[model samples]
Target: MALLIEWKSGGNRFMERCNGALEAEILACVEGIALALHWTMLPFEVETDWLTLTQMLQSREKDLSASAHLVREIRRLIDGDREISARKIHHAQNQYY
Candidate 1:
């Protein structure tokens, strides 16, 4: 199924079209990380319901699949930045605030 990737923080929000749920999740993460870095917000935590995505981000090895580039981009963005991390949350806990 198609997915809508969105990131909302304070008064700022971003939306983007994605082909799938995983891609959407990844893109949303990318947007969030970029924004956090832009705002100079250190010690940022990215909460996600997708366990695979969380694991992928925490992995030490490289991803060589179709979405490898996007995953790599995420790594590039957070590399050497210990202030950023991705955490897995229960699907029910991911509701709108």
Candidate 2:
């Protein structure tokens, strides 16, 4: 839950410093989605322990928070893409933690 993002695909890895947990979570998802898009990896699910973040991304309404742009970008990437989805999981179930 402490701003951690880890991925393993063909020996590739990505990590970045973030100011807070929320930013880290958003950035992680953005990076993951972008990577999936770049690699043409469809039918993937993004799992997160933050229920609010998950709901925000799934909502159709606008987000007026400071991270609205990133949220919108996430929606755009996921919109019309039935192959992509977000799921809320328990913190204990998160593998990256």
Highest lDDT, which number? Answer: 1
Tens digit per residue, CA lDDT, model 2, 1-97: 1233345333334655556788778887888888876765446777889998898878878788878888988888877745777889898877631
* lDDT of all predictions: 0.77, 0.74
RMSD of 1: 7.6
lDDT for predicted candidate 1 compared with the true structure: 0.77
Q: Would you give me the overall lDDT of model 2?
A: 0.74
Q: What local lDDT score does residue 22 receive in model 2, on the 0 to 100 scale?
A: 86
* Model 1 stretches with alpha carbons more than 4 Å out: 1-17
Model 2: which ten-residue window has the lowest total lDDT? 1-10
What's the distance in Å from true for residue 54, model 2?
0.4
